[model samples]
Target chain A: MRWLRLGALLLVVGFLLGTAVWLRPFGSPTAFEMDDYFLKNAQVEAGANNVVTSVVFDYRGFDTLGEATVLLCAVVGVAFILRRVKP
Target chain B: MSVVVRTIARLLLPWVLAFGGYVIMHGHLTPGGGFQGGAVVASAVALVVIAFGAEGLKGQKNLFSFLEDLGAIAFVALAFLGIGSTFFRNVLAGGGGLFGTPVPFGPNPGWLNTGGTLPLMNWAVGLKVLAGLGSVVLLLALFGGKEDG
Candidate 1:
């Protein structure tokens, strides 16, 4: 049984290695049109020097909103779980 | 826990809180942002829990919940400000009111008064994250199967 588990683990690791080897090199973009646009106009359009913040909070804001909601839900759930029951 | 640990925590607390504030405030110009800054502050709160225990925490959980709701509401309201054009629009940018300074193209020092709705959103998210994470830490410390020292 132990050997079977070890064999499975090895198979999974091998698959992951093959996938990683097949993946494209880092820092190489397939297209630059969007990147070019953001670089050229983020400051003027978003009116912020930090393009990353503008992108996170402005360009992709709904995602951030969703993230905030998730966090809120998690906090609420934890609070509920920790609350003492009258029973 | 011990006197030495407690003393060190006391000394480090203010600096942690200040650094978190800096990250949130400088979200538009630096590497950190509302969520990141809030997490930093929350870590300080956790440190307090570990060093002093939940009994040492002053505020109630209800207060933290209220602050969390307030942050969420304010963030949504700010997002709606952009609805005049589209959702999440930068309505305040270049408008010369609040956070509306127009920034020139290229690298510069980056103004605090710029970024229109960005700063407002950052504040909202920062508040939400701070309260949310702080509440989580407080609750865990309160009910973690170990009595407060």
Candidate 2:
């Protein structure tokens, strides 16, 4: 019974994924453009050439900081949960 | 099943690791980023743990922690330089060098040595993800492996 339910869920998810892949949203732009405009500008300001690097460390640095914090919390959580702390 | 699987994973692990490193180093000039490359590296380690058992990866505990800490420190130190100028500013390499001599490298963009704090942040992320993911896999494998007695 559980296996059947799992199979059903997988089938549903696969259908949804396939539908989304083939379906286009209403009036979406056909052409793609660079989303790293801020990074491009930051290159001159930060005196860095790599746009992605500039974005990560200079332009969108707060995001990077948050990402680091997330990693720290995850590591701490893993250590706490796995620690050989006795009752 | 066990022997065949172990043989295949063992054969593939080194190649996976090398490709991960290549992706990481060339991230500045390529499409893949630190997280992608780091996960690949960690996945390679995970394969080894799966094949050889948790004991095989136990020797790497200290190395993992060290890399994580060093990456964090390098990232923060780079940011602190920007504190006086602007948050996350590339303030270093303005001028001055050892014994009043001109520095070998100074504020330039696009080169490997350039990018200010970006490369440092990338290295930090690479270390953190690689270590964190490997550790997670190790713990799961250790606790999950058991045979009915």
Candidate 3:
């Protein structure tokens, strides 16, 4: 059983390695149209020096909203799961 | 908890909270933003839980949930502030109002009052994350308790 578990772990590791090797080189993207546009215009348009912040909270505000919703649900889930546990 | 653990938590709690506040407030000016800052604050809460146990957190779950809801609602409301142009349209940029200062064309010391609705949104996210994570961990700790605190 131990050997079987080791073999399974090795298979998972090999698959992960293969997937990593199949990906493109680091720091190089195939498409820069949108990225360039954001980089160029994010400052003046978003009025924030941090381009990433502008993208997250302005250009991609909907995504951030969704993230907040997700966090809410997570807290709710934990509360519900432990609802019966009295402190 | 051990005395050393309690002492360390007491010493570190204020610093942790201050760091979190800095990250949240400097979202537009620095590397860390709302979510990152919220996580930092949540970690501080966790340290308190670890040192003091969840006994003190009793009855606080509702407060956390309420604050989380408030954050979520505030974020959505702020997003709606741009309904005049379009959703998420930076209406405040260059308007010279709340978070509406025009940014220079390049890198400079960023202003706090310059992110339009972005800073408000960052604050909303920070509050949400802090409350959400703190409550979740507190509940889990309560569940794992071998006896009531």
Off by over 4 Å in 3: A1-12, A85-87, B146-149
Candidate 1 per-residue lDDT, tens place, B52-132, comes to 888868566777778898899999999898787898888999889888889889999878999999988888999899999
What DockQ class does candidate 1 belong to?
A: medium
Q: Report the C-alpha lDDT of model 3 over A1-75, residue by residue, as the tens digit.
A: 999999999999999999999999878989999989999999888888888998898888778777777777777
lDDT per residue as tens, model 3, B1-149? 99999999999999999999999999988998999999999999899899999889888877887888888888888888789988877777789988888887888876888978877878888999999888878887887666633
Sorted on lDDT, best first, the list reads 1, 3, 2
**TM-scores for chain A, candidates in order?**
0.85, 0.61, 0.78
Model 3 score (lDDT): 0.86
Interface RMSD of 1: 2.8
lDDT of 1 at A84: 57
Interface RMSD of each: 2.8, 5.9, 2.8
Residue-level lDDT tens digits of model 2 in B18-63: 9898777665545566777889999998888877888877778888
Q: Model 1 segments beyond 4 Å from truth? A: B146-149
Q: Give the Å error, residue B130, model 1.
A: 0.7
- Which runs of model 2 end up more than 4 angstroms from their true locations? A1-43, A46-50, A85-87, B92-113, B144-149
Worst 10 residues of 3 chain B by lDDT: B140-149
DockQ of 2: 0.28
For each model in turn, which proportion of the native inter-chain contacts is also found?
Answer: 0.78, 0.38, 0.81
